[model samples]
Target: MAETNLQVLLRRRPKGAPVPEDFEIVETPVPVPAEGEVLVRHQYLSLDPYMRGRMSEAKSYAKPVALGSVMEGRTAGVVVASKAPGFAPGDSVAGGFGWQRFSCVTPAGLIKVDPQEAPLSANLGVLGMPGLTAWVGLEDIGQPKAGETVVVSAASGAVGQVVGQIAKIRGCKVIGIAGGPEKCRFVEEELGFDACIDHRGDLNAQLDKACPEGIDVYWENVGGPVQAAVFPRLRDFARMVMCGVIAQYNVVEGADSFGGPPGPYLGAVVRKRLRIQGFIVSDHGWPRYPQFRREMLGWMADGRMSWREDVVEGLRNAPEAFIGLLQGRNFGKLVVKID
Candidate 1:
């Protein structure tokens, strides 16, 4: 068992975008598990867009973290000890174990994994949260049909990649919108998107070219300008799943330069009879996780699905990696590898 634990704590709240100094690495003795709990030695830590919302003192569906807590994240780890029944030492597990080298938590929040089946870090990306987010939002809410055009923003990221591939499997003509040519190429070539437009290019023209059929289903992972561009192109009876707003994640806390509320597109929503729904993945559809896991894992095993990870080497680099995530710096899943 590990003798000590190290953690990345929030040193100062970010004003706009985060910087490395906003997090502090601290060392302490490893914790012991309580009843029904196991001690985990974290190996891979997930960096997600949702963490940006947690950094601020703003009100949201999830509670904000206090000023000096270890930054919150979902991680995959190995159980070094267990007081919890059914949890054995050396069991690989996934849970909200935070940004730490060690964790002690109840079995309620942790799920065991078999490493021989897949890469362990994949639990933090393709077969885990990002995968579940994409699957639920697209399959349940978007309900895309065959022969329709399915569009996804942040097209090269973990969630977007899987979402696009799944759409392809369902026979949708898939279009992906990513920030650059490299990412766009990956989406088209590697992930089998029908067309991948560079959002950083002349977005309007590119989108117009890509989705000549109009957008039948839009899996929204980006807000701001991308949303604006997509709005004008939605087809009649289109469906939209609002997942995240990476574009606005970096806007400074208390910045008044932000624009006013959007004008009513009530006419478009009504006339087109579009179905638009915003969802936080965990809260909305986790009850179906078993089904999602079975299907996605099989897809992955059969090489019918693909994924990518932008892994930073150590725990100390998480802040910079997270900062990059808000700015579209990561090409896919962002993970801090601790082991």
Candidate 2:
């Protein structure tokens, strides 16, 4: 058993972009699980964009983290001890164990996985939330049809890559919008997106050239100028599934006072009869998880799907890696490997 547990605690709410100073890594004696609980030795931690919202006091679908609490995150780990039914020592599982090296928690919300079937870390990425987020949003909201044009923002990232591939599986023409030439190439060549546009350049011009048919289904991720560009080109009855808005997640607290004219935007929505739906993956995920898991495992095993990881070594590096994730510096699903 591990002697000490290291946790990354949120020192304070962030102002703009988070600095390493905003968090304090503290070491404590690993806890012993009581009844109905399991002790987890964390192996990998998943860092995602939605974590930014948890750092604020702003009202959201869930409560914000209190100052001085462990920073929240999903983790894949092995059960080192268990008082919980159906779980035992050596069981590989994943849970919202926060950003910690070890945790003692109930097995009620944890999931068991077979590391032999897929890399254990995949339980934190493609076979987990990121992949599920893509599947849920695309199938439920996008409801794409064959030959229809589907565009996804942040298309080289975890969820975006899956969104484009699934759209292609359903016979849709998939266009990916990524930050640079390298990511764009990966999206098109490796992931097989029909086209990938560099979001950093003349976005409107590039999107026009890449998606001449106009966007029929947009799995929206980064929503700022990209959404503005996509808005005008949305075909009638198009659907916009709002999965994330990473672009605005770091606008210094209390400095987010700007809303331009809504008339034109609203007018287009009415005229085009566009359907826009904002969702958090958890709600749709649990009920549909069995299907997602069965299908994802097959896709991965058959080599029809692949994913990338930008792994930062050590739990101590999580704070820096996470800040970089918000800045779009990490190339793929960002994870911290803890020994």
Scored by TM-score, the top model is: 2
Lowest lDDT sum, 10 consecutive residues, model 2, at: 252-261
Per-model TM-score versus the true fold: 0.96, 0.97
- Candidate 2 segments whose C-alpha is farther than 4 A from its true place: none
Against the true structure, candidate 1 reaches a TM-score of 0.96
lDDT of 2 by residue, 283-311 (tens): 99878988999998998888878888888
Local distance difference test values of all predictions, in order: 0.88, 0.90
Best by lDDT: 2
Specify the poorest-scoring 10-residue window by lDDT in model 1: 255-264
Q: RMSD, model 1, all Cα superposed?
A: 1.6
